[model samples]
Target: MTVFRLPDLGEGLTEAEILEWKVAVGDVVTVDQAVVEVETAKAAVEVPVPIAGVVTELCAQAGSVVSVGEPLIAVGVAENSETARYREEEQAGSGNVLVGYGTSTAHRSRRRARPTAPPPHGRVPRVISPMVRRLAKEHGIDVAALTPSGPGAIVLRKDVEEAIAAAARPPETVDEVRVPLTGVRRTMADRVSRSRREIPDATTWVDADATRLVKLKRNIRNTDPDARVGMLALFARICVAGLRRFPELNAHVDAERHEIVQVKGVHLGFAAQTDRGLVVPVVRDAHRLTLAELATELARLTDEARAGRLSPADLTGGTFTLNNYGVFGVDGSTPIINHPEAAMLGVGRVSEKPWIHKGKVRSRQVTQLSFTFDHRVCDGGVAGGFLRFVADCVEHPEALVTHL
Candidate 1:
């Protein structure tokens, strides 16, 4: 018997939720055949069967979360069959042992099902993490009164807190009912935490007059009824130009290999705020796309991200990231660097501001650009120069057409 274990889907992910199982017991699977779909923090990926054989048992059911090195499925192989030979080959290390290994099918365990009993009046079913349960008990909150927001009616930490807060309010006061954070929300938290702790971030801010860019967008909107030029698309173009001027900023810092992997094409990730959480979807080869094309792709990505229809591939291979915090009426903030990437750009809120131009005071539409870089890979001078280049492009919107 050959056991299939959950594999690491990259980005140091140690566990994944079983989104679906493509194969069932008594079904035959071929080598490299996708047997299950698992969702990690980064994305959802299909895991393939290593050895061809009949599936004997599936340990984890759909929607069940499994840790790394846990046995997921068991494949039964004939004693003298080709699958047995392949298993032997795999054990001998002849075949690649990539990242995750196969599980041992010696014994299989079943997961316990949740109780189906209806709760009493004015009480909600609680589905909570082990840690949250202990915390709730300590806080004197009734766990049974908390509604579960986890997968398949499970309880979460946020659910417990919201329940406690609602319980504290008066009966006459209507509270906004709590909703569980799932799918994208869970994934975003993991990725953001990883990026924050792993990357060394440094930020530099510069103010620029976006008067010309705003006017150009207005002209486009006037000429073409369907054209909608947002600040993000304009900034994306500027990022591509800056990346072209300094190719070093367009590279990934591979710390394990101790090498800088320089990318030829420009793939920019636009950070969009969705109802679930912040998701950054990539626009591949932004340098080759025209302003209209960039606008279209950005719109599409933003819509998909907001709708939670983004695929795994849509979120990968980002050379750089842009966060437009200006829309929320905030001046500037030190944005966190996306891991592996050297830097990230934050566009602050744009508003009318007084400035001295040609020794004359004038009000202009100005915004602050915050460029956050990984200090380990880039110096202050290099980071400043890149920000200056981006600011110059934004200030002179007409110059972008020539580069395009």
Candidate 2:
């Protein structure tokens, strides 16, 4: 029998909640086939089968939380079979097969710490785990050059402290700053810091007359009684339509690999404000839903998120994100892109203003639309066009009604 443990999905992710199982006991599964969907703190990811065999048992049930290294499933293989023979050979050090997230037996061995002694033959020495040694090799760093500061002559985490720290100047004392880095502040700080350091962002703002849209929403609320469309719903609808026209905006920047991934589907993320922090629950396939449907989903998602009942799946797979800072009494602001996504739109509050309408000064509800995009994937022209499309849609609400 082959035991499949829940794999580490990402850095620092220890446990995951089993959201669904694609296979059941007695079902045959092939290697690398998706067998379950697990929800972690970061996102919902599908776990694949590690071996080809009939599932003998499921150790965890749906909605049950499991930690790493805990067996999730057991697959039964035939005795003296090709897979079993290969496993025996692997146990004998003939190279183990890496399937799904399975690690090799070589990684399971414990390393002995170095003894306290003077330099041996004038050679530098270091103590580290087998995993750290492999990581050092992959990073082209000399492990022997590092000093071990851990107990029992082992290299603890601090041993890899910044190489240039010794030569750096000490900082002068300043006023102490202390604040709780939890909830919204922490998330905003991390996102903004990363965006400032990693992404080359450029923002464009366009002031548009949203009078027609506001009037349309008011009319809908009055007529339907059950259908209440807000400005955010209209904005989401406009963004979906704009993406169809300019698909390049609906993309993600893979900075590590230096690639821009354009997604085909429209998973729109709406920034919902709560007392704790701002949560963005995504509406999968927002383009497929009508304005009313989008409004309803947005309402439901916000309600669930505020109630702390949002599942991990509701937060992932967002191709585009929209932040309505206008609801907070802000006129306009540049919003940071959700990591892995290339662009984000900030919708400002709609306020009545006097504007020149066909050679006459008239009152109109004007709102500012801010588009912040990763310059690496999008240029000024593309970003401007997307903003213009949204502005046009909001100004002419009839267009959205006809299109939908």
Candidate 3:
């Protein structure tokens, strides 16, 4: 039995949730054939089998999560099976096989970390990693002249570069920082850097009386559990209503066209903080969804987001974003605009505080809402209006229908 282990989808995700099994036991699969859809923290990806054979065992059930490097499927190969002939032809053409995540191409054999060495060297030492040789060649530095610095007396890239640098000038003190920009962190770095570089962003904020919104949610929960609205859904509805009044905040700046692209629909994305990282899963056509529908979707997407089961489609094409930093028990935050979109609405935690509602002083639920916008799309007037509209809706949820 040939075991096909689960492969790393990306971003060094250690585990994946099996969403579906495409092939059952006794079903035949070919090279690079997708056998299952597994969801990583970033997206749902179809994991493919690397060999051609009859499926013998389905190691994981649908919805069960499995770790990387664990056997995902087992395939039985007969002597006369096409897998042998396919592998033979594959060897003749290319030495390796495609594994997972649709990374199929001419699979070239990766070089070993070090090359073979001579038995006894009258010269300096052995070289490790072909990169060391390449570095030495590029700099006209002789490996035999420099002492090996790594384990097993092997010449390293750093050693070669240091030798060249020492030859260039005497060792000098310098200040420089280096880091690996990779995975989701790398993606965030790129997007944030681009946003800072490209978008002229500005932030504005205001405090809202969320007592009525809280009371409304509480009343709904008390009466009907199924129709209850979450704070996120309430804010989402208000945001959609605000966007209707101040549509400029719900637009994107088109670089090529040099115009503000106003989106007709609200693909509302909410910031979901997870163990992996902060990901925004968009609820498509959110403006059309009722409060109950929005609550359901928000709950489902939030669950999927936590499970790392959101697909790529769920992560992109957002018209606007809602960030509730209050879940972390904070008052407010100037949320960064998810690029391509002009604005983001931030909700801080609602807390009990002394306030004068009507003629009497009492403790009421209060929360701060932060609104950030791209300066290119609109100025302070438009931003302030959008923010005030949202606040008004939060302070009095009745403004929702009027704006809609």
Candidate 4:
């Protein structure tokens, strides 16, 4: 029997919560077949087994957190050349983790059943991932009845969600509700609390006439309809430019070192709300990207965030952040800074409002931009200047050419 231990996922992650097991005891398995899904502080990842054999034992129960280097699964294998080679690879440290490990194309047919008894049809549901199974099970929906929308006729999370929407849910009576914070939500709470406790933070706001920016996007689209330059991308460009002018805002207050380390490039992060929770995906080297390039990257990251496919590297090393709460149709918000990042810029909704244009009252597109920063990094004057620069770019996008 070969014991497969949980290797480090990445970014020094020490523990992961067992989401579900793909295989059970007495089920035959192959090398590199994903045996379980685990949720780390950063993201949800599938861990694969190295040896090819029968699953003897599962080390931990679902929903339990397992530390790194702990036994995850046990596989029984025959004493042959292949088994010896696998053991040798494990000794060399390549067989424990998924990263840098190669998977073989040779795999036998595998089968898995729900924790409960087989359905009336006596066939297992063709589900794509453990998450989809969990979603269907949570809603008490029959997985086999749900139509598959994913490739290869596999049931996806969206299919389960659609079924849930169509099915009427009966209201339940309950007392006070309590939810244990786990996974990403838990990490977010810890970071926010730490930021409030350690950093001296302040907020500043300004209302800008976004009519010109709106017109600019329309003009660009008219020239090339394929250019999906969104408002958030334009705001990202403006924020990157502002950071170039005020490098202090693009820095971290290293209390241990008693120094302010200015980050080298504009690794811009933006807040994206997913079904799991709020996640900020960072775009590295934003200063070097064009407006169109920024839009593409932002759209890609947003899709990855919503689909729960973002990796640990895609979510860290952010020097600054852009929060577009405008999507929620809110007027303004004083958001807490993403811990360790020096500052964050929040953009409110762009709505039609009465404004003075050329000394005359007129209806125009307007928005409020809120800036939050750690006071230890810079004074209010610098914060105000950076906010003003961003506002000016929004009001008069022509000024962006100078910064570019």
Instruction: Compare the candidates by TM-score and give the number of the best one.
Output: 4
Better of 1 and 3 by lDDT: 3
Model 4 Cα lDDT, one tens digit per residue, 1-404 = 99888876767667776766778888888877878877665656778776788889999866566887788999998887767876776677652444434356565427652352343665544544555577689889998887776433456566777889888766677889798898778878988899899889999999999999999999998897776898999999999999999998999888998999998799999999998899899999999999999999999999999998999899889999999999999999999999999899999999999999999999999999999999999999999999999999999999999999
- Report lDDT (Cα) of residue 389, candidate 4: 99
Residue pairs in clash, model 3: 326-349
Q: How close is candidate 4 to the true structure, as a TM-score?
A: 0.57
Can you write out model 3's per-residue Cα lDDT over 1-404, one digit (the tens) per residue?
77767755445556766655777777767666777766555555667665766878989865466886677999886655545654464345433322344334444222211232433654533534444466688899988888865433555556777888889996778998996766555666677778888999999999989998998888878887987578988898888888887877889998998999998999999999886678889999998898889999999999998897888888888999999999999998877888888999999999999888998998999999999899999999999998888888888986676866
Question: Per-residue error at 105 for model 3, in Å?
Answer: 98
- C-alpha RMSD values across all candidates: 30.7, 30.3, 28.2, 28.4
Candidate 2 collision pairs: 326-349
Per-residue lDDT of candidate 2, residues 113-219 (tens digit)? 12234446766434454444554565555656776543324443334334334325487689997978886558656866887788888999999998888888899
Clashing residue pairs in candidate 1 are 127-155, 128-155, 326-348, 326-349
Error of 2 at 272 (Å): 1.5
Consecutive 10-residue window with the lowest summed lDDT within model 4 = 94-103
> What's the CA error at residue 116 for candidate 1, in Å?
72
Give the residue spans of candidate 2 off by over 4 A. Answer: 1-179, 183-188
What ranking of all candidate models by lDDT puts the best one first? 4, 3, 1, 2
List where candidate 1 sits over 4 angstroms from the true fold.
1-181
User: Relative to the unseen true structure, what is the C-alpha lDDT of residue 169 in candidate 3, on a scale of 0 to 100?
Assistant: 96
